[model samples]
Target: MANSPVSPSTNDDSAENAAHGKGRPTPSRAEQEAARKRPLVANTKEERARARAELQARREKARVGMEKGDDRYLPVRDKGPQRRWVRDYVDAGWHLSEWVMPMMVLVIIASLVPNVTVAYWSFLVLWVYIIFAVGNMIFLGVRVKRKAAEKFGAERREKGLGWYAAMRSLQMRFMRLPKPQVKRGQYPE
Candidate 1:
């Protein structure tokens, strides 16, 4: 059954020979021989690594070969400075805490409280507070990233100086660490 060829009864038949029960069907030797070939051997680690490297290189070539704004691809090139700026912000490892989500649930609960003082006025106040807190957290994240980049002597303008300055100022205000008050004679300020 493994080497079975195409059914010959389905082919053109002679009506006059049908009465004589005469028809020798042709056997496909090529297909039968193909089915008899030996299976492939198992691969070694080095062979596997080589195969993986080849596949990776192929994928990288395909990615790099695409035009900037080709609709078929994801358009690897950035549109403008604004889009690039946003992309950098997204790349800065910004994230909210696991506890923050639950705290937001608590905020919702507090907002739904039946008490007038706690719910009516305080709800709006708490909502604003939460927004600012989350905003400040993200702001501080970007700021710390910028300051670290600046402290290590990387470009500051690329990090968005205005946002970085605001975040740094906020952090300095809360942390209360004395700024480096360098005197005129001080060399490493």
Candidate 2:
């Protein structure tokens, strides 16, 4: 005679049956609330379409606010209080290190009037490229965060914070600091 699948007595399913009984207790109220608060991971096309529609609505709202010069919900453009800190830091930092040192070194090296004046100018151009590249990366990060915050909310804005932290670690690595890592079962704080 064939044995029933749900019967744990079957040798093939003894291991799984050992782990769980027929009846399980219900989850606590706190657990239920936590599950409700968790972000929904869409697994179906319908859910994805709904999420996209909601996102588009948010962007449209921000766009209208921006066109009307009311930035209460719109991302700050080139000039806004949100950009003040970023602009000041990037401008100052670039001027101090990205621009000043490379320009000074090139000028001083060229002062001796070596036959490689053309080469020195070429090197200066390369330095300018580096400054622009790094500056763009920084600007893109700040802009993305600002736009996300404006479109969605602060919680969603924090989603890209990991990338910013990674960039910071890379900068610190150049200064000889140890890269951050997880210890054992410890997770992100």
Candidate 3:
């Protein structure tokens, strides 16, 4: 103790620290609240227009990011590894649903024929196409769920995917957003 070079705390040191804005006491609740207070509305039209422009700019950025399939900007429905896998799985396959639109046009032309048999057959073919489309979608959903369960978990298997899968399958591949990353027949592992 006699050889130690220790200095005791002093009021002068406290004053010096305070002068430097170091170790100062925290502001009271009222003081903090006053600092946060702001006008409830914009004071001028220019301010409101500037705010709107900023919001639009933000939305445009997000829109571009989402189109590029950036995970950060993806809506909740499209975000997640599981959703990506499902998208890849759907994109990598050809669906009966893909032919529905063209077949409908063909059927429309066929039905316009003056013959009753042709009209009946054309409508019948359309009905069959619809049934096949529905079946393919059901099959796709089951496969997606099974594969997702194996790769992800049972929780994913139970997730409602029937409608999402059907909607994606119904869309023409070229028209689908976050455009198909995988080529046809290149199913995701």
Candidate 4:
């Protein structure tokens, strides 16, 4: 046994390791980290300038795509077909609350009038309009949620979708992001 070059157990272990590649040496933590590390800033001025230009180009591309509502470049919140459909649905219809902000601005300007009668009237109008807008928003939210659930299924309906749709409805048609793919009165199927 002593004269033999390798023991029986050693031979069996080597055979098992060879079959599995388990005998190969593992990398050290530092070596692994070093391999992973990359220089964010390029070494040369020209290289740095090129990197910056490339980054700007990418950012511009993303901005254009996002504005166009391109699915590949859309944010996680706006990525899905359901969200797009919701936007289209909201855009195709005119909601009373869409004028709320502009009306509020008018109210504010009216309140600043030197005449006490005008200011008082403006305040009264503002309160009445706010109440009406709130009710309109509530109705819109309910309808949007119902439609979303019907089209996408209750399980597929995303959290905050109701609020998202309601908010989009509140914005002026021209001001909404991904710029109203569907024209007014042209609701998606």
Residue 37 error for model 3, in Å?
Answer: 13
Rank all candidate structures by their lDDT, best first, as comma-separated numbers: 3, 4, 2, 1
Question: Which pairs of residues clash in candidate 2, taking residues 3 or more apart in a chain or in different chains?
Answer: none
Residue-level lDDT for 43 in candidate 4: 92
Per-residue alpha-carbon lDDT of model 4 for 1-189, expressed as tens digits? 477586457565576576777576899999999999998767999998998999999999998898889998988888888889888888899888889889889988987889999988988988898788878878878888888889889998887777888888888888877888878899877
Q: What's the C-alpha lDDT at position 48 in model 3?
A: 99
Per-residue lDDT for 1-189 in model 2, tens only? 998588436574577776776587889999999888955698889999999999999998876665443537534342343333233233223222334445656666665675687766767776776676567666656654665476556774444442443243224222311212222233211
lDDT: worst 10-residue window of model 1 = 172-181
| Each prediction's whole-model lDDT (CA) | 0.48, 0.50, 0.85, 0.85
Best by TM-score: 4
TM-score of 1: 0.29
- Supply candidate 3's per-residue lDDT for 31: 100
Q: Order the candidates by TM-score, highest first — what do you get?
A: 4, 3, 1, 2
Q: What would the TM-scores of all predictions be? A: 0.29, 0.26, 0.67, 0.73
lDDT at 84, model 1: 34
User: Of the candidates numbered 1 and 3, which has the greater lDDT value?
Assistant: 3
Error of 3 at 72 (Å): 2.5
Residue 146 in candidate 4 has what lDDT? 88
